[model samples]
Target: MTFNIHQDYSEDTGIRHSKYSETSGEDFYHDKLNEIFYGCYTRNEVLELVLDGGDDGYTPSFLDESIGNLVYDFTLDVVKTMLHIVSDWEPYWIDEIEKKTYPKWEERRRKGEQATITKSHGAWYRLINGVPEKRVWIVYTEEQ
Candidate 1:
């Protein structure tokens, strides 16, 4: 839905401000779309809203940025979920152990000694429903 920027903003002034007054056309929607994006929803729900070929909340200007962030977050969540599934119970213990044993394990491996790495067992779950732990992903590219 288009936001009515012309609505009365200040009672004392009775002045209606246009969103265009502050930012360019593109940026105005970017800000608005980002506002809706911060709400808690499953990755799938957000993706469906943005890309499932529907008019439901799909604003033209902010489409690219919102879609990009949504895709990145969804991919991260999927990977995290898969890792948790593969590890089964180990993810739980790994999440809890308040220690970084990676260095020691690497040292042992470098010394030609087989080191048993300990991983915690547990499922990966969101602390708050619908919010991802982090919004970061790595892209690996190969040179031809």
Candidate 2:
């Protein structure tokens, strides 16, 4: 089945907003086509450009910026869903552990004493609650 993906351009706000239609099995292909036509870059092409350094040297293009934003939004959603799943399982694990070990573990976790998971992106997640608590960007400087 064919689906329609609309890109609305707002003149007042100067923003392009995408409206997607729900499609069952062909959603992946549809989304890729939308990205290529509206966003001007496919995910695989963006990855290839980054890995191959753009066939020669680095040259900035509109496609690069567009794909970068799309990647960021997509990754943020994935991370949020993962955090939700982990958080949902926390109470079950805590209950199981309390039956065997000290009950004060939950109390300590409530007081924000839980361990954190750190990622290369400088994002930190609380292990007990699975909340994305902090994000820090590391800036690199080249020395002459």
Candidate 3:
């Protein structure tokens, strides 16, 4: 059975986020995948759910990050092959990645002060000292 992540994206479940549910869009996306990874839905169903989210339509950010992490178990070639099936839905060109990488936490990584932002594999993570050793958020960087 497929799960409807957003029964109503417009309605706030009181999850509390900087802008919306504290669970960044990417993390929420992962939660859905967990269902797939565990056999709740086949990979194809996962792709279908992604292809159909929101008014602007789900952005690549929503799928790319989660899909990239899939390499932890599935191969880069396998993920690419899956993406190829729904090529039209992707916003950008996603080619084969030689290595699959997950966002990691950095310390004193901001403005010379260490601003670290990384994405985590699952929902809810622990912070190491104040910076998460795991990726939970996406970080924007300035030139060195």
Candidate 4:
């Protein structure tokens, strides 16, 4: 079954316009795709469209960007849940989430750093779906 985020859930058109339609950053999806990204995990179609509203699918770079944001808004586990919910609770979404997006979330979630990112880099970053992010050497410099 082909999925159309805009047409399928017209009830949320207002949200599709304001929240999901923004293009500036991640975490923008923020729990919406809890019912949004099933297509990417199961069927085949637009990943970002459901969030950022467009008519495109799976460009290497776009896929990369969308994955990061999707993990941020909905953890790999949650994305899996969303997909399964659409699949009548089937578990195949597990394979897709595990292969495509889970490792990054797992490594960070275990380390317990999502809170750090939320506090320190919250303005610049879109926090890690309540999980830790890849650790990095953050250096803030001041010049005279």
Candidate 5:
């Protein structure tokens, strides 16, 4: 089964930005750490479901064994510690265009000039704030 993980950020202006990632149930269970971070599932929820043999309809039955094994391999404290190591993550561009791109985009928007912005290339994972994150660069162009 495919699961969509979404992250949202809200600005002071009340505008919200959302980012999403799609992962298979197998991959999701394998990673485990992101279960809580991505808000897909919480460690407590997994533990309760597996231990109590209860179903909330969120976790797929096929992943039960994998989730059980993951719980068995590590204690809750250990999982918490591991999660702390990588507190959060964000998308980033591999080309590292933030410095140049943001200023130009802001200037264009400020001046009410016509412009086009695009992003391409595979997201490269990197470390930021002691967390592993995917990076995506921007391609900016002026409208003719």
Candidate 6:
């Protein structure tokens, strides 16, 4: 049986993300997964999923024995895009990173910050600690 993964794309960050859901309420065999795809998020989580037999999230004995085959349609562009969006969506643990980053923008940052802003083609921008600095971060759902 072929596995179908779900895809989600966000324009603000210009990245796509994917998640796989069981269709028949039954665990899929490793060999049954024929076409796996990834959006712009990091591959580490996905890689772990592919090798779930030994990963903490999935039981090793069940995966190693019952799992069949696994394949992936990895897309660098999608990964890049997802990272772009995620970086803008969440910066850090601090309450207001942008306000703290740039003192000059403190006044403006205090006024509800925008989740993301577009700078140009292939370029996404976000503020941190009130500073006007550019940064990129990768996001994985498993991490959350």
Candidate with top TM-score is 3
Query: Model 1: number of clashes?
Result: 11
TM-score (C-alpha) between model 2 and the true structure: 0.17
**Please, what are the lDDT tens digits per residue for candidate 6 over residues 51-86?**
212112322222221211110111222222221211
Higher-TM-score candidate among 5 and 6?
5
lDDT of 2 by residue, 64-108 (tens): 222223223233222222211111322443233224222333334
How much is the lDDT of residue 23 in candidate 2? Answer: 23
lDDT tens digits, residues 65-123, model 5? 22322232333333333322111132221012223333443454346452222212233
Ranking by lDDT: 4, 3, 5, 1, 2, 6
The Cα error of candidate 2 at residue 127, in Å, is 26
Please tell me which model should have the higher TM-score, number 2 or number 4.
4
Off by over 4 Å in 5: 1-22, 32-59, 75-144
Q: How many clashes show up per model?
A: 11, 0, 9, 0, 6, 22
Which sections of candidate 3 miss by over 4 Å? 1-25, 40-50, 57-59, 81-144
Per-residue alpha-carbon lDDT of candidate 1 for residues 83-126, written as tens digits (9 for 90 to 100): 22112323432332112233332343345442111221122222
TM-scores for all predictions: 0.21, 0.17, 0.37, 0.33, 0.20, 0.16
Question: Residue 77 CA error for candidate 4 (Å)?
Answer: 4.4
Every candidate's lDDT: 0.27, 0.25, 0.35, 0.37, 0.28, 0.23
What is the Å distance of residue 144 in model 4 from its true position?
Answer: 22
- Kindly report which residue pairs in candidate 4 clash with one another: none
Candidate 6: which stretches are off by over 4 Å? 1-26, 30-32, 37-57, 66-144
Instruction: State the weakest 10-residue window (summed lDDT) of model 6.
Output: 9-18
Q: On a 0 to 1 TM-score scale, where does candidate 3 land against the true structure?
A: 0.37
RMSD of each: 20.2, 19.7, 10.0, 11.0, 18.4, 19.1
**How well does model 3 score by local distance difference test?**
0.35
Give the per-residue lDDT of model 4 (tens digit) for 4-68: 33355332232111223432122223223423454354444434333223343222222233344
